[model samples]
Target: MTDTPHTGGCRCGAVRFSAAAAPHHVSYCHCVDCRRASGAPVSAFVGFAADSVSFEGEAPRRHENGPVARSFCASCGSPIAYADSRLAADIWIMLGAMDQPAAYKPTHHAWVREQLPYVHMPDSLPRHVKSSVPRPTE
Candidate 1:
């Protein structure tokens, strides 16, 4: 992990967070859950070890859907993070919430099979039909 820290917050500045270590993974997700939670065609995230992150100010409200828990800012309704118990040590933070979103480099795409027909995505990155943690039979 590099010495530099990653910092971010909600759109309304009601919630803030930081990561002290390098991200384990950075990728885009096209799952229906992610798209619905973010209100976008696709969601991009950076995964960091749970222990490496710190939250401050008003805590975001959480909504659990099965094994996944999504946290969002109550003040501005911006999605903050996604946590899946299957990846216990990892928490994926929404790239849009980052202070430096331009610095993010997505490595791959997850849940590509559910991607919307109208959403045009880059072809250079690897695309996973399902999550690596557990393949959902559709």
Candidate 2:
């Protein structure tokens, strides 16, 4: 955490959010659900504890599917965040929505078993078929 927060907003600027503390997890997801929702080959995220994050402007619309619930901006249909019941206290905000996307470098690749064949990332980061987030300690 620092005096200057990590900030970002929706495409339409209808939704804005900020994280005050350090992120718990930063990774790339290559699952089908993430690819379809983001309309991209892969999706990257930076996770912060729920208490350290605050949203302003319009509330994001949510899509719930079993244990997962994704939030997006209603105005421009931009993905905002991803939440899973398994990680109840953390919110994974899409890297694409971050004002400083370059600052958050993904440390690993998740759902590698479900990754598309043509999509390749040659980085030596750890790969997890089904990841158990190594929750960071304060």
Candidate 3:
């Protein structure tokens, strides 16, 4: 685990959060589901152990996306994080919501088959047809 502090908030500044440890992994998901939900080319995220993060101010508004649940600030509509009940100990935070996004790097590109034609993926990172299995470290 890396000793890096992670902090972020909603667009309206109503909801704030901080993580004491570095993320388990970061990635850009190009799946159609992600594109529709985020209304962007790809959805970037940083994974962390659920217990390692702390929230302050107002809680996020929850939305159910199939098997996963996403949370965001109701006032500003800033995508905050995705929580999976199946993966009880982990939470996926939106990388764009981070205050210091540079501290994290995408290790992989997920749902490559759904990626837009004009969107070029870096050759350096691994690409997968679907959500990759979480490694033991993650």
Best by lDDT: 2
Tell me how far the alpha carbon of residue 115 in candidate 1 is from the true structure, in angstroms, after superposition.
0.9
Instruction: State the lDDT of candidate 3 residue by residue for 28-56, as single tens digits.
Output: 99988778778899999999889999999
Residue 105 shift from truth in candidate 1, angstroms: 0.6
lDDT of 2 by residue, 32-122 (tens): 9999999999999999998899999999999999778999999999999999887789999999899888888999999899899999799
TM-score of every prediction relative to native? 0.91, 0.92, 0.90
Q: What is the lDDT of residue 10 in candidate 3?
A: 84
Write the candidate numbers in order of decreasing TM-score. 2, 1, 3
- For candidate 1, the 10 contiguous residues with the lowest summed lDDT are 129-138
Each prediction's RMSD to truth: 2.5, 3.5, 3.1
Q: Residue 4 of candidate 2: its Cα lDDT?
A: 38
lDDT of 1 by residue, 9-120 (tens): 9999999999988888889999998888888999999889999999999999999988789999999998999998777788999999988887778889999999899999
* Candidate 2 global TM-score: 0.92
- Which ranges of candidate 1 are over 4 A from the true structure? 1-4, 132-138
